[model samples]
Every structure is written in C-alpha cells, then in structure tokens.
Target: MTGATYDALVIGSGPNGLVAANLLADAGWSVLVLEAQPDAGGAVRSSHELADGFVHDTFSAFYPFARASPVMLGLDLERHGLTWSHPPAVQGHPFPDGSWALLHRDRGITADLAERAHPGDGEAWLRLCADWDAIGPALIDALLTPFPPVRGGLGVLTRLRHVGGVDFVRTLLSPALTMLDGRLGGEALRTLVAGNAGHADIPLDAAGSGMLGLLLTMMGQTVGFPAPQGGAGELSTAMVRRLESLGGEVRCDAEVVAVETHRGRATGVRLRSGERYAARRAVVADVGVEALYRHLLDPSDVPARVVRGLDRFEMDPATVKVDWALDGPIPWASAPEHAPGTLHLAASRAEMAGATAQVASGYVPAHPFMLAGQMTTADPTRSPAGTEAVWAYTHVPQQTRGDAAASGPGGTGGTVGGDWGPDDRERFADRMQARFEELAPGFGSLVRARRVLGPRELEQRNANLVGGAVGAGTSQLHQMLLFRPVPGQWGRAETGVAGLYLGSAAAHPGGGVHGAPGSNAARAALAHARVSALTALPRSVGRSVRGTLGRGTAGGGAS
Candidate 1:
C-alpha cells in the first residue's frame, strides 16, 4: 500500500460518511471520501432549478431528528453556518368542513385546540405529551446509539421497570386508530394526529405505528420542524465544511465498485473507473446493505448466515414527491393561524388508516393522506417575494402489481418500474394535485411550476436510498435493535471483514441526519488501528495456540 493513500476512506459523501471522515480526521488520520454524485450530501440537498429564486429541498425537508441528535448538537452546526427556522404552528390538518386542527409547539395551545375539537381530547393530549416527554430523550438516545442499545436499552428499561416493560410495550401496541379514538373525539383532530403517524410505510393499524405519532409529536414540540437557513443543501454544505476543516478530502463522481480484500481481510476499495484507494485504517461504506453485501464484497467473503439475513430486509414504503413553485401561500378554506407548517389533508382517523392500508395493499388510496409543506414560509430565502416553494410526499406500496389502466387515467397502479419514468412521475403528481384540489379547492391554479420524483428517481440520485426507502430500512421492531442489518454485529461499525464498516442509515441508529453511525464507525476504526500496534504479542500467542490445538483449529479460530 502507498503511504500517499489515506488512513481512512469513506465510500460515500452522505451525512454519515462526512461525520465519519470528520471524526477520523479529527483524530489525526488522513481521510478521503468518494461520492458518486457531483456534490456532497447524498439526500440532503437543495436546488433552485424548479423556479428562479425558488429553492426547493431535493429530498428530506423536515429535520426533527437532526435537531435532537447528540452528534449533530455536539458538532455545533450553527457555528458551521447551519440555522434552524420553524413556522408559527408546527403542523395543521384541514378538513372539507370549515375546521382545522393544528399542532402548536406549545403543548398547552395544542391541548386547547384539541379540546375545542373534542372535550376530553385536551387531557388525553396532555397525558400523552407528558408520557412522551419522560421517555423521549431516552428513546432518542436508544435510537442514535449503536444497536442492542445496551446503554440506551438499559436506560429505557430502568425508566420503564417501575412502570413495567410489558405495560409500556402494550401501551404502544394499539393501532393509531385505537389510540386516536381513545384520545380525541373530533374527526379532524383524529386525522391530524394519525396522519403524522402515517409518515412511515407502516399502516396505521400496524403494531408499532403508535410510536411514530408519539415520537414525532414529542419531537415536533421539542424542536419543531426546521429547515436549514439558506437551503436544504446548506446543511450538507456545513457538514462538508466541517469535514474539510478537519483535513478530510471529498472526491465526487467517484463510485465505489468493490471492496478489495487480502487474506480474508478487507484491505481497500476499487472504484468503478478502475482507480484504487487503499485504507490504512478502515473503509467505511455509507451505502445500502444490499449494495454493500451483494455488490461490493465477494459472496465468499461475507458469512453465509449474513447473506441469508438479507432476505429478511424489509424496506419502508415507496414515496412519490412533488415540488411546486406556488404563486402564493396555499389557499385554505379557513386560513390557518400560523405560517403553513406541515398540512395534513385528511379528515378522519378511519380515512387516514384506510389510505395507508390501501397503499400497503398495492393500491392507490382514493383519499390519500398528503403531507404538504411551505418551505419558504419557514425560510424566506427559499422563494421570490409573494411566492412559496412547497413540497408534498406520500408513500405507496413498493411493488404494486397491476397496470396503469387498472388504476384509471391518473393512478399509480402499473408494473412497478425500476425507475419512476417521466410518464409515471407526471401521473403521480397529477393525482396528488387532484387530491389537494379536493381538500383545498383551487389549489392547482396556484402552481407556477411543478417537478415530481418517484421512488425510482430518488434511488437513482442516491444509491444509498435503495428502492427509494427513505427511512433507510423499515423502522419496525423486528428490523430494529440487535437485528438491525444483522444480529451480533452491534456496537462495532466494522463487519467481520477487517477494515470494512457499515456507516450508513442501514447501520444501527438508522436514518435521519443524525450522523451517529459515521461517528461510531470512526471510533471503531481508531480502536482497531491502536490494537494493530500490539500484533507481535498476538502472533506469539497464536503460535502457542497452533501448537496446542493443531493447525486447523488455530488458524481457523483466527480467521
């Protein structure tokens, strides 16, 4: 290996990759990052091409987890030119009738709004809020840390022990409908709460769906949905700046082709263009698990059990995103009190559940739940004066089996294409626009320009986002914890192969812009490098083991 090569090579320039590079560089290791795209920030980026002076988030818009992440906080992103802005109200759900339920940052105000909608809902909101407030931090800790959550798991257990884990788990077991029914009375209020819970691919009736509502609500109250100051890309820009400041280098347009190994140990990587970069310390992959195991490493290099575990990989629902340059603020029947936060366009809990169920069953919902955001409302720089940059996204079944005709003219039903071709993109966008028109009349007229990206487009842009599954993988219970990626692979970011580590959303503490996986991987690489210095002693011990337990067992155990 050449000494000119870096000590650490991060194979993706996503948030996780940047974080890992920063950590390694900060620890005095020469780090390099290779990005397949022309720029950094895999999914966290913004562009003004949708309309002049109108900046729109290319992908993820809201940053609930980003604000609360300890890793993000520790970086003091604000100092790195990151600023957060929130709307007056966190979110709102508008109904056909002249009624709207809003989520205010203030619990009291939100409770009062719930009360106005339904008498006892105020108390229920307060109780749920309080319960979440107690466990929210612990949950974040458990999530942001590596899996097994040994420390975080212990903390959660300690907190829930007195309350009883069974009871706590049971409390979160009820479907969103059941929970909302027990808590709120009005249809609008129920829709407001349950719609937020349906952000993931999980059906509202799914076992762990309730936690989505609780966690998102608590996070919204705590940090509000915020966007970067200049644009979504600014967040990524800040990360890149920090990594560079720490002596890290990022090479864009460099796609990793394979993980090079020597003597059953990962040694470096080969780029698609045939360029090779050796890792003196570690090779951190910020790509999807499927890409990592199936494409990058040789099958013989990966354990057979790990390969079988890939079958259990459950992806979140596919998403259809629409970005529009609005002539003005959305024309709601009853003007919402706050600058538009996230708008939920559903009326009842059952309606929202049915919509989610429809999507889960490979059918487009007649009344799809839409999450609309006015980006410029939160950050004025997003659009020209008197105009708003808005976006809406909804999840659909991954591989819906049907024809476009079956779904009618403007439906999503078709042989699930690998890429959301231009035709399907336009159709999905039109369907969403029609939905908005029904919920808020004349909404279509306000659009100055429109752009759409379906699951396939999203995946093409960012290989890390396989199948356009944004939440990395399914955030459900079975795929979470020790079972994340695979069991017995917790704590250490490295796989069984030396010098190779999983540092993407596919790893534990999955998804969001948290950067925990990258940080964790960097720490593991540093430890491994330190341990390498004492290899002489280990070699002597290895000789004794070989003499005692025959050559087969001795070299086999080491391997």
Candidate 2:
C-alpha cells in the first residue's frame, strides 16, 4: 500500500528527528516521523525491566546539555508535561582518601568544597566560574547553533576582552589536563573537570578536550545536570507531545529500507514492508551519517566525495552499560555533603587517562573509568522510596585486541578476554562493580538485580549506535565543524541531494541532546522550499504569457 504524501518525511524518531518534525509542523508543513524500533524516542527511552518498581534510562540519563540548550528550552516542554529535576549535587568523584570532589548546583558550595580540599582552590574555582559567567553563554550559543555562529560568535568576541581575550581562547584550546594543571592545584576541581571530559571520547591530553570538559563543567555549575521528573523517556515524550500538538505525526516499527530519489533530489522512502511514503517538500534523516549514505541512499545518488569521506569517518568507541536496581542508596564510607545525581569512578587522574588511552589503543582497560547516574536520586519518581535506580557505562575498543586489565596501569593481573562474550562481559561487569565497591563498601549487596548491555546488544537495540558508538562519530578536532561528517560541507545539514538533510548526531555541533542538527535541517528545508518556489515563479509566468499570446493570435485570425 502507498502511504499518504506529507510536506516532509522524517526518518528516525530520536530527539533530533522529533525536533525537526516539530519545526516543520510549526511552519504548517505536514510532517511524519518514522521509527524502526517498536517505540519512539530512540536512545531517550526508559524501562522497568531490571526491577518491577525501578525505572532505568535505556541509554542517556543526565541531561546538562538539554537544560542549557536554547533549542531545547525554546520548545517549552514543561507545558507538554515535562518537568526538570535536579539532585542535591550535579556530579561527584569519590577519592580513595574519603575526600570527594563534588560539583554542587550552588557555585558558593562548590567553591567551599574546593577550598576545603586546597587552601587557594576555592578562590580559583570562583575565578574560573566568573570568567565562564562572562563568556560561557555566548560560547555555548556559538557551539549549539549552526556553523560559523555569527551572532553567538560576535557575542563571544564582544565579551572576550573582559575575560582575558586571547588567553581565554588559549584556555579553551588547551588540553584538559594542561588547563587544570595551570589553573588549579586542587585535585577536587581537577577531578571534576577531567571526569566530565570523559563524557566525550576525547583523550584528556588532547587539544579539543579542554573545551568539551570546560563546557560541561561550566554547564553543570550553572544549569546543573537535570533529568526528566519521571524518566529520560519523559523528555522524549514531551518532545513528541509538543510535535503532535503542532499537528505532526510519528509512526514506530516502520523500518525504512531505502530513500527513493530521482533527478538528484529526495522524493520519498520505501519501507521493508513494501510500503512507499512520499515526501512532497523534504526528507530529513536522523540516522547516522554512514547509515544514511551507505544503507538508505543508493550509491549513484551519493556524491563520490561523500563516499570517500565515509572511509575516513571514525567512530568514537564501543561501550558497555550496566543497570542496577539497588535496594537502598549507595553506602559511602564518607558520604558527600550533597548527593550527586551523576558520579565518576576512577582511582586517580592517571588511571582515567590510562583507561581512555587503552580504548584508543584497541584494548579494554583493566581499570575502566565509569560515568554513573543515580536516576532515582535525580528524579524521585524513577523508583520506589529508599531504593535507587543506578546505571554506569564505560568505553571500550570497537574491535578489542587485548584486555589491558591483566597488565595495564593499576591492573592486579585480572584476565578478561577481548571477545566480549558472556564470560568476558560478566568479568568486566564485575571489574566495574569493584570500582563502586571500593568507594561504597558492600555496594554489591544492595543490588536487587542487574542487566548489562554490551556493544552487540546496544547495536541490536538501536542501529544508529553501530557497535555501541554513542556519539555517532568521533568528537575529535579532525572531525568537527567544517570537517564533520566530511570536509567541504562546512557543517551544513543539507546532504548533496536536494531536499534531503542529515539531522543526526553525525552532523555539525555533534552529540548531546541539543536539537541544533534537527533545527538546522528543518530550517534548511524551509529555506530551500522558498527558494525553489521563487525560482519557479518566473518560469510559470513565462508559460502563461506564451499561452495567452497564442490564444490572442488565434482569436484575431478567426475575426
């Protein structure tokens, strides 16, 4: 059966796709969003499979980016039954000495904690915050918007002189470790910043790492890492609700096998079920770049340069995530003053760097650094009272060559094979659990149940997560901005095919829950539609003029 034609057809109902559909609908365009999965929201989903009463976010949990993104905020999701919830603190890093590095929502409390750790660090922390206060908003605006960020970049430049100008730029460009070493002597502040940098696959010692680390840290300081009041799915639900309210439609379990095109333009898509849906104006894809070019579109439709660019495209790394339904809160030897929603587990800075290096070198680190979330703590509605819904994820090599834990840094001669089979997965989960056990004694005892999702499982659940590489692609300097997805494109949402746009994480201003990629694509579609209509006006008039002249000549001859 053939599906009804819409002004635009959006592939994938992830946050990006939903955002695009909402924008198109706002412009009075008929938009339909298709999702291959059984449910909508993509990675922004949740389930109670681990425990009857516990709600666990399937993929991404804490959303500091969503709280800070103007694109997300402008949607007014709160009106669509979405409420933001923040834990007592934003992020925490527990040390072996029982000292904790916690980022509190209040800058004063965070500074006080830093001061307690190091004499001069309190003032240093505030100084950095003040500088961020001066330019962070503008910088973030520049980051979350389309490339060249003229308005936001100008906002940044106008405020630069007040915030160390060239030195500020240097600080943003510096390596994460180098920035921390130069600015603060306290391990607490350093740990917080460095651990946040781990959220990305960038190495701590790399050039572009500082900006990401600082961006997240500063965001936590200001907006805080918030979660939807119920679950991460609520965020997606809110987006879908908003889109539906705007007259957009979403259909799940509809797998698109191919994007049908003709005359170098996207026309519609064909589903595996032999159904064809026409898109009158545009087709926005919220899938990975590789999936769009390789699987969806025909080879003849893809530009040769893009085909070549795909060869150089590098995925970040594979991942392994574990979820637990804890009977009670994590019992810490020395509890943080304010419980944090998110925590970073690593013995030290060196160990954290070692783990990332191991992954980059195609080995699974023995002492993997983990980014964990206390979902119940972040949003009390996630689970029953007095219980916790916790989850953690660590990066691994896309194709494991060895296990570094057996002999790598901080390794205690543990042997876990690189195959990532059931045995290997269990062993690695045990290894990660041990890290928590170190900080919270008898932490394993509180687990009511546990579930693990490795690379294979992740890919099975979400095709965009190819090999469990969550960021869509590497967030390195070499693949960002104009170089993103491919060079010569200059971070545009438009694919080479007219009326097609890449609205996924693989596009510019990559990753995070920010809606820039989708918004960019939607705007591009609208712009092109206008241009096409305007360009067609003269031709339409010329034909009409010729017809009128012919009719007049015939009438005169007959007379």
Candidate 3:
C-alpha cells in the first residue's frame, strides 16, 4: 500500500481503462488496473441476470463500435478466447403491414430490398453505402485519433469533392428527419435511419443529428453488428487475459476513492480502505468528467476554465433497459426471420419525432423509440436452445430529481415529474413491453424472466454511466471532440493536473465500447513522461549522485 510504485495506474477496469492499461503494458510499463466492481468490464459486462444459462449484457451489448475499434483489433482479443458472431441481417425496421426494411452484410441485397420497398431508394442506398465505403476508413482514422484529425478529415473531403463536402456538411448539421426526407422512398427506410440516429437522445428535428443515423447505418452495412460468441463478458475475459500476459494486473473490488496529488501533479491514488498506491509515471481515470472534476481531485487543484466547462458538460438522455429470457423468439407480425439483427419498433416517423422532442425537453417519450436486440438470434450461446435472450433500451430524460411538467408518451402534453422511483420505472417498462407486443404478438408469452435497469440502477452498476447517460456524454456540437470534457487540448487526458489523465468516455471520442479515449490517454501519458524525462536532466543527475552516495550504506542495494 505504501512505498510501492508502478509505471502507470488506471482508475477503472472498464473497456477504456483496460485498453489504456493494455497499451501501456505493451510499451513495457508496469500497470495496475483498479475496479470498484467485484469484476471488470464496467458497463460492457454480461451476466446470467435474466435467467439461468441465458446470458444478458448488463449494460452496453452491441459491438458495432468495438468491431471497428483499432484498439480492440490490435489487441487481438479473438486470439485470447473471444469469438464473434454476426447474424445474416444487420438491422431491421418493421411496419404494421408485415413488411421489413432490412440491411444485410451484402450491400446488393440490402439495396435491392430497399428498392422493392421504394424503387429509387435501392439505387440511393447503394450510392450512400459506396460513399461510406470510400471515405469510411479515413473517417474512422480521423474520428478515433486525437484532436485535429488531419489525414482522415482531408481524405473525406477529397473523396467528397467541393459540392459533396458542402452537402455532407449540411447533412451533419441537418436534423435526421430532414436528411431522410425525399432521399428514401419507403417508410421502412426512413424508419431505419431514424432508428439509428434516435439511438441517441437527439431529436429528429435537432440540428447535427443526421450524421449519427447515416454513420451507424453505413457502419452496419460495412462492418456489421457482431457480438461475442459466448457473451459480452467474454470480451472482458479476453482483455484481462491479454493484460495479465503483459505483466499487467487488475485488482477487482479495489475502489479508488481519491486521487492523491502533490504540487499539481498526480502522485497516486488512495483506496476507500485507506490503501494507497504510489504512481511513478501517470494516473489514468476512466470515470465521468463530472465525477473526476467534482469528486476525485481536490477542488483547489482544478483549473478555472475547466470549472466553467463543467457547466457545459452535458449528459445524454437517461435510459431504461429491459432484458428478458424468452421462452422462444419474439413472434413478430412482420419479418419474424429478422430476429437476429437489431429491431426498431415505433408507431411511425411522426410519433417518433414527437417522442424524441419530449425526451430532449426532459420528459420521457411515452411511446419511447426502442432499439431491441435479439441476443440469441445473433449468438445462440446467449441462451438455452429454442429460447432467446432479448434486450431493449430507449432514451429518456435524465429526470431524477423531482416532478416537473412533462408530456408523457409520444410527447403528448402532460406533466412528468423529474423523480424516477421504482414505480415509475416499472410503469414505463410495462408500457415499452406493451409497445413491443403490438409489433410482435405473443412477445409477453415468451418472457420467462425479465430484468429492468433504469437510470439510477445503471449508475449503481457503473459510475461511468453517470446519470444513466450511457454514452459517457452527449454528442452535440458543443460537447464534441475539441470541446469534450473540457475546452482546449485538455480533452485528451492530461486533466489539468500534470500526471493525471482523463481516459473515461467523457474525454474525446466519447462513449461506445470503443477504446479510443483510453488509447489517446496512453499516448498522452507517454508523451508527458518523455517531456518530463527530458526536463528532469538536472534532477536525474542529482538522483544519480545521491544513489552513488547511499549505495554502500543501503547494504542490500549495493552489489
């Protein structure tokens, strides 16, 4: 606990923490990962919470981001016992008329299906997918790296050309609905895009929302929605296995209470049990910006600009997730065969628009836009034979304080209190199930067991999911890249403190199971260390002289 030193310290065992630890360990650094949970994986872990043998991811499930993650890929988790599964279909948007707009791994088939629904849309889909294919790699490189994504950003511009670049810029700024309008023929295609975009707390009419749906849809088409063969926890197991192999250690049930710093430089961390670990190089925190600034570090050590930025550090919408151990698959009225991919079930585009508006204004969407994942459909290892591990999550206001005026479901005018008690959660969950029942008849009958996790419950599960804002923070214009967590170049780790780095989702490349934040943090830490080492020439010389004097006196230290 005392007088011990490690080359690097990671404050959480979430994906970000594990990734940062792995990266540092790869660099031949002695790293220690501390986790408050009895296990690792943060929100990305899975468990048999729903039923016996039916594995359900406790929080973050889908692996679209992880599938494309450079960090995950470089780590080669697959070689460490992580197997992936991809369903035939990537996504589906069904309607009441027993028709589905599905996206497949095969671009031609997906476009063809779209055309059948809306003839011209088939060509449009292919064009869009092709555009993504061309610039997608560059976009990923630009997005997943540190601020000032020069190469990736330029690659996109060069591919799009002048007029296309302007158009793409407009799309990034336009509301998702606006972008979908007149572009696609069928309601199914429109719903498909909206579903992808609305996965966030953004309103359909909200500016800067169009790109979200477009990017996700395209990613689904290209990389696809793949999950681990066993369960999400397997990803964690693989990561830990890899980390340990690099001489990195992860201590579960080790809660880091406060980061101990001296002279504006992080020295180490103190555990809740009063055990302290001294860090020789740097400390990385994989917690929210709010928690990091308000709790962990001493307020006196904080910079004023960061304090001001905290006011603008917005959290995304809260969520209420439901997981079920179904007796069988959901008996969908349309495209029951699409049980493998993600399903979007909302009444209609207009209804979804109204619902999202309500959520943006801090009220729950009465008919919440739901993203349902058929886990067993994609990976049979998730549940017992003939049964399904079904899970769905939808956005809601981060309303938890007290009652406020709110229009419930579909943004209907009504009062909605801010408080979210067990009763409130249950009521909303029941309504969501009922909504699903409308799309898939007998859905309730297949549910052998169910678990509901609301905003508070999510926070209890993982502090990084602060206020149940799962994606770490909002992806709005003001909270993005160069301005994330805090203003200036401060977003990429190097939290105002010299040796403390913010490796959490609140940092750059916010949220998802992607480990870019951690990757960036590791790079920053290494850079800082190199800079410090160069600056410590005189100090090192003094240390060498002091060691020479003490060599013989410190017996065991002398050869």
Candidate 4:
C-alpha cells in the first residue's frame, strides 16, 4: 500500500485481462494491467493508415460472438462510445456461375433466396433456423460462461431434454457438408454454410465443424455479423475506457518475464525490463497456456506431471491474411442480394472439404476456401468515399518446415517458405485474388493498395496468437471444455499455482473477443483473497468447498 501496490495484477492488456481488471476494480480493489504492445487490445485493435479516412480493423472484423457474449452484453459497451452496425444481410457465397447464396437478417428472406437457388432448400433452411432459435441463446450462454456451464448449460439441457437428447446431439453433430448436401443441393448454398464453419480453425469434415456453420449462420440470421461503429478497435476502446473509469491503470510496453513465487504461491511478477511488481491478491495472466506454463514460470516450481501434460498441448493451424484498399467495390456478376455482408468463395461443400484436406497436407489448395468481407459495405466508416476496404483470411497447417523433402507422405510436395514470409504471402494472395476473380469477375481491378500478414507476423504482433492462430488454440473435441489448456483442472483460473491463473483464450470457453476467462479468473481470485483476509482475523472463518484450497500449484513456464 505504501508504494501503490494493489490487490491484483493482470498480465497482458487483451480483452480478457482488461475485463478482469475492470471486475476487480469495480469490487473496490486497485488493479494494474501490464501489456507488451504499445496498444491494449491483443487481436482486437484497429488502425487508419491504410488510406485517408479509412480505418481498418487489424484483426477480427465481425463480432457475432461479441454480440452474443453475456459478458459483452452485460458490459453495455454501447453506452461507452461503442455502437454496432449490422448490414441487412449477414453473409453471401459467390459461385462460378454468377449466382450466389446469401444469409439475410430476415430468416424467411434468406430461406427464399436459398429456395431460389435450390428447390426445397427453403423448408430445410427454415427448419434449421427454427431448431437453432430454440437452443441458440442457451448454447451461446453455455459457451461463454465457465466450462461445464453449471447454470446456462442446465437451461440448455432442460430445453434439449424436452426435445430429446438424441435428436439434439444428432442435430448439433451433423456435418456441414452432409447437412447442405441433404438440404441445399446447389453449389452456392453449400458454399455459404461451409464458409461460415471454416471461420473457426476446424475443417469442414471435423466432428464439431457443423456447429460452427449452424451457430454462425443462425446467429447471422438472428443478430447479424455486426461491426463496432467507426472500427473494430472501438469495441476494445470502450472496454479500456470503462476499466479506466473504474480506476484501473494500464501500463503498455510492460511484458511480464516471470511470475515470482514464495511458499509455493504467486507473490509478484518480474517484467522483461527487470522491473518488479507485486500483487497482494492475485496475478491473472491473459496469455495462452503455452506461454503461461512453459515460458513464464519455472518448471522446477511446477509439478512434474503438469510439465509432462503440457507436451500434449496443440495449437490451431496458422493463417494468411490480406487487407486491400480498393478503388471500387468488387464487381460481381448479378451481384448477390447482400453484397454488403461477407462473401464466401468456394464452389461446393466438397470443394471446401478438399481445400481443408489440402491445407492439412501442407499445400495451398488450387481452390482455397476463403472468407472475404467488404468492410466499406458493412460499415461505411471503414473506407473513404468511392472506395472499399476488403479483408480476407485463410488457414494452413502449422509446423511445416521449409523442406518438402522432410515432409512425410500426404504432405504438399513443396517446401513451405520460412515463416510464411512476405514473398510467400504475396504469391498466396495472388492465387487467392485469381480464385476470387474466377468466382466474381472484375475482382482484381478493384484493388488499389494491398498488405499481407502471415503466421510469423501474427505471432510477433501478439504472443497469445501463437502460430498465427487467431483462436489461441484449436476448437477440436480433445482441446475443449475442462480439457482445455489441460484436463482435470477446469473451473477456477488457478493452474495449481498459488496466485497465478490462466485468463486467456487458451483457457476454458476458448477464444473470440469475449472476456469470460478474465471475469472467471477475477471472481476466483477475489474469493481466494476474501478467504485469506478473513482467516487472518481473530474470529474463526468457516470454509466452503468453493473457497477450499485444492492440490499444489501446477507451475511451469508457458509454451
């Protein structure tokens, strides 16, 4: 208290850390946040230098999760200079034949469009949307809250039980391609749904990939893929403003090198610059488990079993992103109804599946499945007059060394360039542009200026985005739920470490701009501090299961 030491110290000024700091500060505890970058938002910041009067979102353009996240809604960012703009239609998928499938905010209109493209698809679309409407809210709640989703999940189960669990699981587990094949047979309709599913790291053939398609499309129909007014960074700016309003302080250019310990409890942190800051309450880390357990903490300080378990951690596939300042809008033949929404360019569900397979083999597909957004169409503020800001991103396999000879069978028969450098990115970008041109004619002429970001660039910008994984880690079955980061330890943020906690996307409920991990970590730390403070008093304090200390801390350096 003498030197301005606070009750809690949060490492990393990403959404999670900012949310945690805000929560603790609201509870009357002084909070300090240390960030490595000059800015606060990890993957949510924006810049305007791409063009005059054009603000481009550096990463993460759409915010379906942000809109649906209970934490975000509760924060009421709108009142804090954050407004959302949802285009009439949420997304579209263009095909080689000039026709396209679009997802409109109005379900009936979208169904009509699907029906026009493929007979009987209207009913199938309606049925899918209806089923999603019944459980979508509950599912969103279940996903955003702490794992095992004690409350929201119960609500979901109750609803699902009334409808029958077998049917529920079957509906949720249906493959995107299978569903599209059975319902929407047209190539365009199939591409639309498959494109939404591919937004996550999961392949079209992955078991849970169907959920991404269904949930995102359904959410688009229900809420739309809205962007924060002005720019995506405005969302983070609002969170930062709110945190500062609550008396929380953020220190940029401060990277935590290690978490200091005493008597097996996290005592404080040492910055990369050799400055030390102690937390009387807790040290919440808004980074991936790899960095938290394998890099920051000493392996000797952590349990041997924990270190061994860390070896099993898997990262999502890396990505290649391209941003273009266009002289004019993409010229599509008989433009889709919702040109303002996202444009997915894949001919068929089979084609998308093949593309993922190709990427898994370390080869860039001849027809890569890409999700392209016309930011100027969605939010006019993103670009200048008579111009457009186009953003596109696609994924590739991780850990592919620059030697095709070293790659095993089923691998792409070409060496992946070192770290997906600028030259490689430009080549990939050209291929993508050509692919887009094939789907949407005159697409190439619109580009006035362009910039590309690859896996290495993404990692260098934000450590949380390891291997250019925007989601922090893969959303595969093995890496989800309590198994996230590691199994057997789910609820509390503590990693068996005394005061250290995992409050990043690598934790439960995984990535997006949601702040559930941070909120959960703050609550846990607050509870622990309260119990510890009470115990020090003269009177005896009754202990409860929630407040009871578990096993020893699982300490280790982060990956």
> Candidates sorted by TM-score, descending order?
2, 3, 4, 1
Cα lDDT tens digits, model 2, 51-93, are 8878999999988889888888889999999999999999999
RMSD to truth, every model: 5.0, 6.9, 6.5, 4.5
1-559 in candidate 1: lDDT tens per residue? 2324788899998889988888888889898899999889998988888888899898988788788888777777777788888878888887677778888888888888888877888887887777676677877787777544657667777777544467766766766666556556666556665777887766677777777776776788778888887788899898888878888888999888899899887888888788888887789999888889999999899977778788778887778889999998777667776555677766677778877777777765556678888888888888988888889888776877533335444334433332467876776677778767766677889999998888878888888777777888887767765677766564347687888888888887677788888877776777666555444457888566546645322111111
Winner on lDDT (2 vs 4): 2
Candidate 2 accuracy as lDDT: 0.89
Candidate 4 regions exceeding 4 Å error are 1-3, 161-164, 180-190, 401-418, 537-559
Candidate 3 local lDDT, 50-107, one digit each (tens): 6789899898777888888777789999889998898779898777777887888788
Clashing pairs in 2: 366-405
lDDT of each: 0.77, 0.89, 0.80, 0.77
Estimate TM-scores for all models. 0.90, 0.95, 0.92, 0.91
Compose the digit string of candidate 4's lDDT tens values, residues 1-559: 1235778899998889888888888899888999999988888888876767777888788888777777777888777889898766789876666777788888888888878877888887787777777778888887777666767777788778654477667757877666556556566556677788888767778778887787887778888899888887888899889888888888999888898889889888888788888888799999988888878898777766567767887788788888888888776666776665577777777778887777677665656678888888898888878888888888777865332323322223333464577666776777667766766677778877777888888888888888888887888878887787777675347688887788898887787777888877877787677556656755534344324543221221100
Worst 10 residues of 1 by lDDT: 550-559
What lDDT would candidate 4 get against the real structure? 0.77
State which candidate has the highest TM-score.
2
- Candidate 4 — worst ten consecutive residues by lDDT sum? 550-559
Q: Which of the two, 1 or 2, has more TM-score?
A: 2
